[model samples]
Target: MKKPSRDFWKDSAFALASVALAFAYGSLTWKRDLPNLFRIRAGRPLAEQAQEPNPSLKFTGARGRPLRPFLFTGRTFDVFYFDHVNQPTAEFARATLQATSFTYATLPFANFNQADFRGSYFERASLRGADLRASHFAFTNIIQSDLTGADLRDADLTSARILLTKLEGALFNENTKLPFSEAEAIARGMKRAK
Candidate 1:
C-alpha cells in the first residue's frame, strides 16, 4: 500500500524464479519419454515396425510363379485328393509359408509339421490329411478348404478363419490352440485325437 518493501520484491522474484525452474524441469523430463509415447501415433518408421513377408511373393515357385498344391501319401495312410490339376506341387514342412492368394490350391497329404503359416490365405485350398502338427496358423484363412482327416495336433489357430472348410475327421488334441472352444470344434465335426 504505502511503498513496496524490499522483502516484497525479493518474495516476488523468488516466486517467479521457482515457477520458471519448475517449467524448465517439466519440459526436460517430458522430452525424454515424449518420443516413445507418440512414435506409434505419429507413424513410426517402417524399419522400426515388425515387418511381414509378402505372402504371394514368398510362396512362389520357380521363376517367381505361384506354386500349386502338392500331395503325397504312404500305403499306410488313407488316400487324399486335391482338385488342382494344373498347379505345380508344393510342400510346406518346417517352413514359413506365406501366401496371399492360395485359392483352389491343393495340398492333400502334405506335411506341414512345425510350420508357420500365420496370416496366410488358403481359400478353397485342399489340406486333406495334411500333417500340420505343432504348426502356427494364427490369423490364417482356410475358407472352403478341404481339411478332412488333417492332423492339427498342437497347432495354433488363434483368430484363424476356417469357414466352410471340411474339418470332418480332422484331428486336434488338447495341445491345439483353436480360436473356438473344444465344444465348438466338436460341434463342427472336428474330432479330438485319442
Candidate 2:
C-alpha cells in the first residue's frame, strides 16, 4: 500500500481526541463538589490550581447532637448554638442553624431545604450540591464555603461575608439576594449562569 502522509494521521488523532473530550465534563466528577468550589475560586489565585489541590478543612470541635435526617420548612431558629462539626450528614439539613459555628465541616450534598440560616457561620464549610432552596441566609457568614453546585433558587444571601469562595455551578435565581459584585464574581466560576 502507498504510504499516507504523517500529517493525515496526526489530524485524525487530534479530531478523535477533541470529540472524546468535548462531552468529557458530562461524565467527569469534580472533587470540588458544591462547597469546595467556593474555596477553589476565591480562596486562592485563579492561576494556581495544583498547589491548592482542593484544600481540606480540619474539624475543630463538634457537639454530639443526634444524627438523623433533620428537616426544616417554615420555621425560625434564633440564638441557637452548636459546636464545630467534624463532618455533618443530611441529618442536620434544614435545622434552624442560628448562630451555629460549622467551621470546616463537609456537608456535601446535604438537604437544607427552606431552612433558616440566620447568623450561621459556615466558614470554610463544604456544601456542594446541597439543597438550599428558599433557605434564609440573612447576616450569615459563608466566607470560604464551597458552594460549587448548591441550589440557591429563591435562597436569601443578603449581607453574607464571602471573601474567598467558589460559586461555580451554583443556582441563584432572581429572588436570590446577593451583592451585585459578589454575584458577578461568583458567576465567573460557573458556566455563565446557564
Candidate 3:
C-alpha cells in the first residue's frame, strides 16, 4: 500500500478546520443574519413566479422539526401547532396557509405579507411587529393574540374573532377590511395609517 504525502494531510486538516469554523460562525450569527439572507421582493405578484418546488426554502418548527416551505399555495395546515416556541422573523410572504393553528407560538416580527390565512387560529400567539399587509383573515380566531405594531394595511379581517387581542400601534388604512366599525377598531388602539 502506498503512503499518503505530508502535504495531503495538511490540506485535509485545513479543509476540516475551515468547515468547522464556518459552522461555528453561522451558529453564532444565525438569529441576527438569517432574516436578511431570505428577503422577499416587494410588488411581485404570486402568480408571476413558477410553481416549482424550492428545496432550499426550509423553515424550522418546534423541536427543530422541518416545516414545509411557504412557496406552495393553498396548502391546508390542519392542526399545525407550535407550542410556546420562539420563531421570530419567519417569512411567509405571498403564501397560502389556511386553517392553521398557531397557539402559544411566539412569532414576533414575522412577515406574512399577502399571505392567505383565512380561518386560521392564533390563540395566545405573539405577532408583534409582524408585517401582515394585504393578508386574509376572514373568520379567523385571534383570541389573546398580541398584534402590537403589526402592519395591517389593505388586509381583510372580515368576521375575524378578535377577543382580548392586543392591537396597540397596529397600522390599518382605509383599504383594510374589518368586520367591526372603524370607531371600534380605533378604540382597540389600532391606528389609521396615513
Task: Please give, for residues 100-155, the per-residue lDDT of candidate 3 as tens digits.
Answer: 66777787888889988887888888999999999999879999999999999999
Residues 1-194 of candidate 2 have per-residue lDDT tens digits of: 98989999999999999888865753464433433333322222212321333324211223333333333344344443232333344544456767656666676777788788887887778888888888888878878778888888878887777667788888776677775555484555642334
lDDT leaderboard ranking: 3, 1, 2
Model 3 alpha-carbon miss at residue 36, Å: 34
Query: lDDT of candidate 2 vs native?
Result: 0.61
How far out, in Å, is residue 94 in model 1? Answer: 0.7
Superposed by TM-score, candidate 1 places the C-alpha of residue 87 at a distance from the truth, in angstroms, of 7.2
Q: lDDT (CA) for every model shown?
A: 0.63, 0.61, 0.73
Q: Of the pair 2 and 3, which is ahead by lDDT?
A: 3
Cα error, residue 177 of model 2, in Å, equals: 1.5
Choose 1 or 3, whichever is better by lDDT: 3
For residues 105-190, what per-residue lDDT tens digits would candidate 1 score against the true structure?
66567787887777777877877888899988777888888889889999999778878888889999999999889998998789
Output the better candidate (2/3) by TM-score. Answer: 3
TM-score between candidate 3 and the true structure:
0.62
- Runs with alpha carbons beyond 4 Å of true place in candidate 2: 1-77, 80-94, 181-186, 191-194
TM-score of each: 0.56, 0.55, 0.62
